[model samples]
Target: MTVPAHHPAPELLLDYAAGSLRAVQSLLVAAHLAYCPECRAQVAELEACGGVLLADLPPEPVSDSLFGTLMTRLDATVATPTPVPAPAGKSLFPGPLRRAIGAEPEALEWVRVVPGVHLSAWGVSAGTASACLLRMAPGSRVPAHRHTDSEMLLVMKGGFSDEFGAYRVGDVASYDTGTPHHAVADADGECLCLLVQDQPLVFTGPLGWLLNRGFRF
Candidate 1:
């Protein structure tokens, strides 16, 4: 994929630097950073600012028993290192996402969302949000839907387009509750993306009703 022209907003980058973004949001940002050097520079600057702030804080005295307590715990315990996930060959997912999903994209079992559209929800639990890989057949059109919470879509293969603009590989499309748009996959090939939603979508119209009945979001 070519260098990404679109990126996560500055506010999102700041939140990421501050460790205030939700887990999935952070993962999305990390994946973008892997492909975007400009954003990586911005995040590095933010971290430097945070380091300066930390250095300026006044030091506090430690409790009298703190040293003894730490020594006793250290002597009594054996720390086990955390296990790391192995790479799944050539994959579109960045490190964090690969760790979360634990397999190559082709290995996942996808469920049909609608005709010509399928998805594989993240195996791990999400806090107040949901993350998944959505796959759309060439020339397919996703039903028009509006969000109840924020949504971020990062294209990993092929392309898709909505009213905002066409998004190719490595491009990101973010939407808040008020932005309602239907996406159509490019006719050339299937479109694959990692989609993170802060809350379930509130799809519009009769078609939405049927879809909502069959699927939770």
Candidate 2:
């Protein structure tokens, strides 16, 4: 595989290494890390720094009841049986993503959102956030839209290009609130991307009024 040209911002990687990123965001970062050795190395360095910081911090006291509760939870966790791993097979999604969605991408039932665009929503516990797989047919273009909050896209297969730049497999594109852009899939092949958004997209095209009317993207 070609090394990805795009990556999560340094601050985002720092949050990921510190274990402070939201679950959905972490999932995207993990998928990107699987394809990015450079980012993985950076994360490792950040983690080491975190460990040093922790060592320098003073210890805090824990109440007996709290400690007992933690022990009980730990015991319960240990008593629980390990889940069986999914049978190995060919797949485009990364391990974190496959586990989150509970299946391979090909096994998902996609819902057509537009003429040549499909979506498969993955129900996960992300407060005020949504996670899904977006698939665009070759040469298909998503209508111009603005993000309501932050949005992150991790290319799983094929590629797409927007005003910012072209994104291929393993590339991560992040957009902040109110940022507007149009995306078109590569002409030769369909593009599949893992998308996590803090809020639904806000369409900014001529049909924006209709598309933004209670439509969840």
Candidate 3:
């Protein structure tokens, strides 16, 4: 696999290291880390810095009630063992994503949202945020759209290019609310990506208006 030129911003990495990111966001970052040695190293550095800062801080006493609650939760967890799902057959998906979806991309059912574009929801969400997989046929173009809150896309296969730039496998692209753009899959092959969004997308233009009336991304 080619080394990725794109990565999550420093602030996002810090939030990830601090365990502050939402479940869906963390999953996207973890998927990116599976393919990005550079981001992995950066995360390790952040963790080390966090540890140093923690060591410098004075210890705070935990309340007895809180400790007891934690102990009870641990005991209950041990008493009721959660079953781990069997691993799906070999796939191109990263470990984090494969574990989350519990199936290969090709094995999952896809729903067409538009011409040459399909989506498979993973049913994972945090508050208003949600996660899904997007598959685009070769040379297909998505309608222009803007995010309502925040959106993150991690390339899992092939590539795509937008107004921002091109993104290949392992690259992560983040968009803030109101940022408008459209992406076209590379002509050479299909594009598969993991998408995590804080809110649904709002489309633009004539085709977009028609799509928005009937569909919700």
TM-score of each model, paired residue for residue: 0.86, 0.84, 0.84
Tens-digit per-residue lDDT, 47-107, candidate 2 = 9999999999999987869978998889888575788876758667887887777788677
Greater-lDDT candidate between 1 and 2: 2
lDDT of candidate model 2 versus the reference: 0.85
The 10-residue segment of model 1 with minimum total lDDT is 121-130
Give model 3's TM-score versus the native structure.
0.84
What's the CA RMSD of model 3 in angstroms?
3.8
* Reference-based lDDT, residue 8, model 1: 88
Off by over 4 Å in 3: 61-89, 207-210, 213-217
lDDT for 140 in candidate 2 is 96
For candidate 3, lDDT tens digit of each residue in 1-217?
Answer: 7899999888888999988987888999999999999999999999999999999999998786998899888888757568886765668899988888878877888777788988785547778888898899999987778777888889999999999999999999888888887899999999999988898777777677666643354
Residue ranges of candidate 2 with Cα displaced over 4 Å: 60-87, 213-217
Alpha-carbon error at 163 in model 2, in Å? 0.7
| Native-referenced Cα lDDT, model 3 | 0.86
- RMSD each, Å: 2.7, 3.4, 3.8
lDDT per residue as tens, model 1, 99-159 = 7887887888887778888878554437877778889999998888888888889888899
- Candidate 1 stretches with Cα past 4 Å from truth are 64-88, 123-125
Residue 101 error for model 1, in Å? Answer: 0.2
